[model samples]
Target chain A: MHTLHVELGERSYPIYIGRDLLNDPQLLGAHLTGSQVVVVTNETVSPLYLDRLLAILGERALVTEVILPDGEQFKNLETLNQIFDRMMHDRHNRSTTMIALGGGVVGDITGFAAACYQRGVNFIQVPTTLLSQVDSSVGGKTAVNHPLGKNMIGAFYQPQAVLIDINTLHTLSPREFAAGLAEVVKYGLICDLPFYRWLQEQTPRLLAREEAALAEAIERSCSSKAAVVAADEREGALRAILNLGHTFGHAIETAQGYGKWLHGEAVAVGMLMAMELSARRGWIEPAEVVAFRDLLRVINLPVAPPADMTPGQYLDLMGRDKKVIDGRLRLVLLRGMGEACIVDDATEEELVSLLETFR
Target chain B: MHTLHVELGERSYPIYIGRDLLNDPQLLGAHLTGSQVVVVTNETVSPLYLDRLLAILGERALVTEVILPDGEQFKNLETLNQIFDRMMHDRHNRSTTMIALGGGVVGDITGFAAACYQRGVNFIQVPTTLLSQVDSSVGGKTAVNHPLGKNMIGAFYQPQAVLIDINTLHTLSPREFAAGLAEVVKYGLICDLPFYRWLQEQTPRLLAREEAALAEAIERSCSSKAAVVAADEREGALRAILNLGHTFGHAIETAQGYGKWLHGEAVAVGMLMAMELSARRGWIEPAEVVAFRDLLRVINLPVAPPADMTPGQYLDLMGRDKKVIDGRLRLVLLRGMGEACIVDDATEEELVSLLETFR
Candidate 1:
């Protein structure tokens, strides 16, 4: 098992990467300070992995379970209320620890649930999906999607520990796995150029679920994320660069409805749009755009955005994204495949042209 | 204006207590780091104070207003959802500062909104009601109520500053003013015996809204709370004592349906219950219980709980309160008029006897 500490001082916690670590009592045991444990999972992953986790948890604490309905659509105040209701019903106090046991949706909801559950509770992410393990599971960013924008209601609450079991990836569909890779590729595009090149070289191995390569990818991606989060923990300035493709991605998701396109898939196309815009502005050469698009395509992600959405609609939707600062659209544009910067003055005309070209 | 600093290291903020400080730019000015500001208020307070606050905020940055329906029934995931929706629609980023410009309900919902808006945002509490000025405005306990329990969903996010405008209380109803005093009297019961005695002697002065006495009460309550919060900023252990009457109070509010009884009114009755139970357990003398109940009655607050509810129902409700520790009924029992201790193993039979006696 490999371990990386997200250096957030007292809020700092470990991200453990290995195969079958979910059943490892040592990893889960380190974060359990109390006797009451509530495991939050969605319907899909519960049937597959709940027993393994329950077995690991043993008879130490009273383990309560809240199984939510599956899908991004369920990620709202209503679903969040359900978790709160369960917490109230069970009389779970601040000392009660919450364990998130599913993909990004479950992790996000559970983290936020823990964040607001009695002012906050100790929550550990037992991520069961590639997307959660690679990206959502590490950062303190926990949120629920809104009808207007994706992830509009949330908090940046760090988890007690993240227990990532790579073996759980076997349960994910190939398409879902590819969707997660889009975020894995995101780390390379934003900060680590060498990692991007390495991802290009190791795509086949990662897709084939090769243990060593997949482990390396997850480790490097987390390290890059931890470094960025540590530097700008709240995503105030430098962290906005991490939203390289998220602005366009949020719009795409909102326009298409939340559950239709996976967040990673939308981000894949969004990254393509960002690169196309960067090329138009001469921030990156046309070839880097091709490289970015090719990598996303290789992972079976949607490289080009959907054609039906108009530039105006896209721009309007993007305007509603959380990244927009002071009502101005702040686009994360690339200097190269390895670097990105926030562009605050990008005009609607520029975005419209970029959207037109992509369509 | 009286000033009290909440001394929370980096999260520390000033509580400005006086009349007409809401329009005083210096209080809001020092905290305004960014250009974007979103003022959150409820329907009742908005028509009264939102415009004045908006005028003070001026055209600086992109100023937006979100008006939620007034009352505690609206203080839930649904209302919190509306605030997030408005924030997203306005493109309010993490840098945006939210001003909670109402009473305790508004301050809590707004503080909670700030806590969840992009993981967290800078929030200022411009408390209009006396209850908020004395209690909710200073502490960082921000939350939305749950269906099963009051404030079941929330966070302990500190604000940048708290501006208390005593002038706004001129418009407050007598019932509302009395509810605010219930919290004011709480400080005296927990750790400030002198303040409690002073309140005992000066009930009319406070109820009459004498500026000097009201200001002193607000300042003293804030100072005592500030000291307690500074000692335990996160409510780790010692802070639980601050919730002397809250276990029973939460039950009253939940059972009566939130907003049916003001938080302070429920707290007033709750404090009486605490005293009754404490006296029955030999934690405090019976004479102390009489004094506590008489004081609540002096303020025209409920001494006895509503007659409709059963002791079992109260037990069930209080059992679900967030203050419970390790499946035990953790009550902050008064040792005397001025001091209290957390008694974690209060027996249900003892509680039933006390409930019957009180009933």
Candidate 2:
């Protein structure tokens, strides 16, 4: 078991990573504030792990479950309202604790529900998918998607604690597992060069879902995300670094119509475009960009956008991104192989030309 | 002009309280962060003051307006989406500033919209009504109502600045002006006894809409609310006192349906109920309750619940309030005539019997 604390002063909580840790009563129980609990999971995840958690929670708390449809397409206000509907119908109040138990889609929506329900309530994240375990669960960026853009409506609300069970990763389909690796690799690209090299060597073990390697990756990724979140908290500046490939990634997610492409899959191709932009900026080595793409491909992740998506479509989509300031698109481009910074100076013609080559 | 700062560290901003101050561009413009500005007002207020604001905002920033329906019935997620839809459709991004123009309902919905739109944007509160200028515009409590309870979904998102124009109150209906005074009287009841006496002395001037008395009332009310909000931003403990009659008041509003009985009118009756509860608890003299009711009556505010509402209905509704903890209904009851504290030990039977008397 590894315990990593997200040092956010009064808002801080620990991320517990290990196998079969879900059965650990102290860890999951410590975060539960009041007797009334609502476990927010999706349809798919509920069938697999809901009973186990219910048993773990025991007869102590009056527990209820809201099982939503399992997909990013359901990650909108309408679906979010379902969670609220259940909560209000059951009369959940400020003291009631919400438990989000599923992948990124579940965690994101559930976290958002917790944020808005009664202005705010305590919630815990038990992220199952590798993408969520390592990334979304650790940072408190809870949101639902707007049709205009991904995560267009949300809050920077933190949770009481996040408990991860590596055992759930065994249920992930091959494609889903591969998608999670994109964000995993992102941590190494943004800040940890040694972790990048380590990941290059640990691909086989990571792919096999080997417990030790998977745990290490999740911990390191969460640690990186926690540090960035702690520094900025509100993404005023430094925290935007954690959004390394999100500008282009959100564009892909929105264009493809969320749930068509997994968040991590879109992030993978977005990272590639960012690297290309970094190369164009004369900051990153061409060899580094090629290597990054090669690593993604080797891990069975898509390294390019769909062939049909035009530069104009990408431009139109990116213009709606939340990071845009005063009509200028602010992108999280790579400074070098292990550094990322926000750049808003790129012209439309330059971005369109780069998108042309990528497509 | 009177300025009262809601001291929330770096999140703090000035509350400018005065008459005919909407045309003061410096007060409104200094708070705006970016060039793209969106003014969120309601139909009732748009024709009255929107053009004046548009003129004051000038050509320095690109401005747009989202004029919504008038009334609290429109203060829901569906209406909130209208703001988001317009902003997204217009390609408004994070740098865009939102200015809320109207009464409490507009300020609240707009503030909550600003809080959620791209995880928040810079927003200024341009409160038009006396109720909003004295109350809602000062505190950072922004929310929209759910069917079950008022303000069930919302955030404690502070605005960049609050610009209150007392001149708009001239257009308010007689009932609307009285509703605003209910909140003004509440400020005196919950904490400043001297202000209560001051309100008593200035009843004629206040009722006549004498500019000096109205301004004084607005400033004093805002200052008291600000001091309380500053002490407890998220309402962990100290801020709950500010709710005073709100629990019963919310039930009245929800029962009657939003916009049927104005918020302040419901609060006036709720304050009487709270005073009765305070007397029942042996904390204050029963005579004080009558005096409080007399004051509200003098201000043309309702001093009793609707004849149709039963105590059982009140119990069912108050149970849904956010103040409930661990399934217990926690209420902000008075410690004395001018002091308030939260109590959760009251029996449902006692409450029902009390409600039977009031009804």
Candidate 3:
């Protein structure tokens, strides 16, 4: 088992990565000191692992489960309110620990629910999906989508602990598994070149669910996210880099209607667009874009833009992105494969021209 | 102006208290930093003081205003969403500072709106009503009511600065002014005895809207709240005392439906109930309960329980309060007149007896 602590002072917590760690009471119990435990999961993930999680929790916690509708379309205020409503209905206080047991959608909504419940409460991330285990579970970025923009209404609430069991990945569908790898690949493109190279070498072993390789991938991804978040807990500066492909990705998701495209899938295609724009602006070579796209394709992730998504439609949605500063679109373009920069001064003509190339 | 700073490190800001600080841009500009400002007000307070606030903000800030429907009934997630929708529709960002310009209701909803937008931006409080100018505007207690309990869903987001202009209360109706005083009297019962006596002597002056007496009252109330909050930021311990009349008060408001009773009025009656219970428990004498009730009555606040509420109904409603710990009723009772203690083991019998007597 590998333990990586996200050093956020009082809000700091550990990310436990290994086989069969989800059922480990020592790790899960460390974060759950409350009398009542509410495990919030989606329909898909609950039937598979809810009982196992309950077994680990034992009879001590007055545990109750709230199974939400699975998918990104349900990741809005309405769903977020249901979690709040349930917690209030149960009369859960600040001490109640909410365990989020699903993918990024569940983790994000659950964490946001915990953030707003009684102003804030302790929540543990028992991330079941690859997308969550590798990415959303580590960082304290919790939010629900607003009608105007994806993740428009949210809060930066750190979790007490994140429990990731590599065995759970066996339950993931091939497409969902590939989507999670998109964010894993993102950490490399935005920050670590060697890790990207490592991911390149370990792709086959990770795809085959080799425990050691998967654990390494999860640990590396968490470390990268943890360091960025710890330095800038509120994403005031350094943490914004984590949203390298997210601005474009959110626009794509909103354009497609949230659940139509998986968050990681949208990000995969968005990352390609970002890299292409970087190459067009002479920030990186054309060959680099090809390599980035090739790596995504190798993982069976979406590399090309959605055929029906017009640049005008993408541009309109991107304008509503939270990343937009002072009414200007701020895109995090890659200075190189392992480096990214926030470009807030990019003119509409420049963005429109770059966006038009998708045609 | 007397300034009180909520020492929350980076999240900290100042609270400026005086008679005519509304037109003083020095304090407002210290926080606004940029040229663009968005003033959030209500229909009632807008026509009264929007021109003055805008004039102080000046042409430098491309001043935008969002005038919401006026009332406590509007204080909910629906109204909160409107602020986020408008902020996004208008493309406001981290740089934009939201000025909450009205009574407690507007300040609370605006403060909560600011807390949610872009995962929280900056906001200043230009409290118009006496309740907000003295109470809600100073403490970082920002929230909207849920159906089950008041402030059941909210966050403790501190503001950039709280600007209290006593002159704004000149237009406040008598009922509204009395509601504000209920909170002012709360400080006396829970923490400061001398301040409670000072309030007793100064009640007539404050009721008559005398500038000196009102300013002193506002300053004292804020100072006491700030001291307690500084000791406990999230109401984890000592901060719970701040909810002196609030536990019972929230039940009253929730039972009557939130908009029917002003928060301060409910709290006024709630404090009376708390004292009667305390007296029954041998915590305080019967005369002390009358003293507490008389002080609230002197402020033109309600001392009796609501007409239709039953003991069982109040218990059922208060059981939903955030203060209830481990499924036990935790009531903050006065040790004497000025000091308070949180008793978690309070029986249903004691609460029932008090309610029966009130009936």
Candidate 3: where is the Cα deviation over 4 Å?
B60-63
lDDT of each: 0.86, 0.88, 0.85
lDDT of 3 by residue, A1-359 (tens): 88999998888898888998866877787777878899999889988999889888876646778999988889988888888788778778777889999999899999988888888888899998888988888878888887768887888888888899999999999989999999999899899989998888889998898888888999999999998888988877778888878887888888888888898998998888888888988999999889777888789998766788787888788877777666677888899878878888777777778677765
> Over the stretch B61-135, how does candidate 2's per-residue lDDT look in tens digits?
567799999999999999999889998998988988899999999999999999999998998999888889888
Interface RMSD of 1: 1.6
Return whichever of 2 and 3 wins on DockQ: 2
TM-score of 2: 0.98
Using lDDT as the measure, the top candidate is 2
Question: Residue B299 error for model 3, in Å?
Answer: 2.7
Best by TM-score: 2
Candidate with top DockQ is: 2
Q: Judged by TM-score relative to the true structure, which candidate is superior, 1 or 2?
A: 2
* Model 3 chain B lDDT-worst window of ten: B55-64
Task: Give the Å error, residue A279, model 3.
Answer: 2.2
Clashing pairs in 1: A155-B119, A156-B119
Per-residue lDDT of B67 in model 2? 95
What does candidate 1's lDDT look like per residue over A1-359, in tens digits?
Answer: 98999999989999999988977886788789889999999889999999999888866657789999988889988898888877777778778999999999999999999998988899999988888888899879999987887887888899999998989988899988998999899899899989998998999999899988889999998899899999988887898887889999888889998889998999899998888888888888999888777887778889888789999889888877777766777889898768989988988777888889878
Q: Write down the TM-score of every candidate.
A: 0.96, 0.98, 0.97
Clashing residue pairs, candidate 3? B35-B61
Tens-place lDDT digits, model 3, residues B1-359: 77777777777778877767877867676777665577899999899999989878866635678999988888999888887778777767777889999999999988888887778888899898888877788768888888887887788898878888788889999999999998888898888889988887888988999988888888888888888888888888898898888888888888888788999898888888888888887878898787777777677788787878899998898887788766787889988778899998777887888889987
Report the C-alpha lDDT of model 2 over A1-359, residue by residue, as the tens digit.
Answer: 88899999999998888889778777788888688899999888989999889888856546778999889999999988878888898988898889999999999999988999999999999999999998889878999999989999999899998998999999998888998999899999899989999999999999999998998999899899989888888888888777777888888889888899899999999888888988988999999888888889889998888878888888898889877888888888877777878888999888888989987
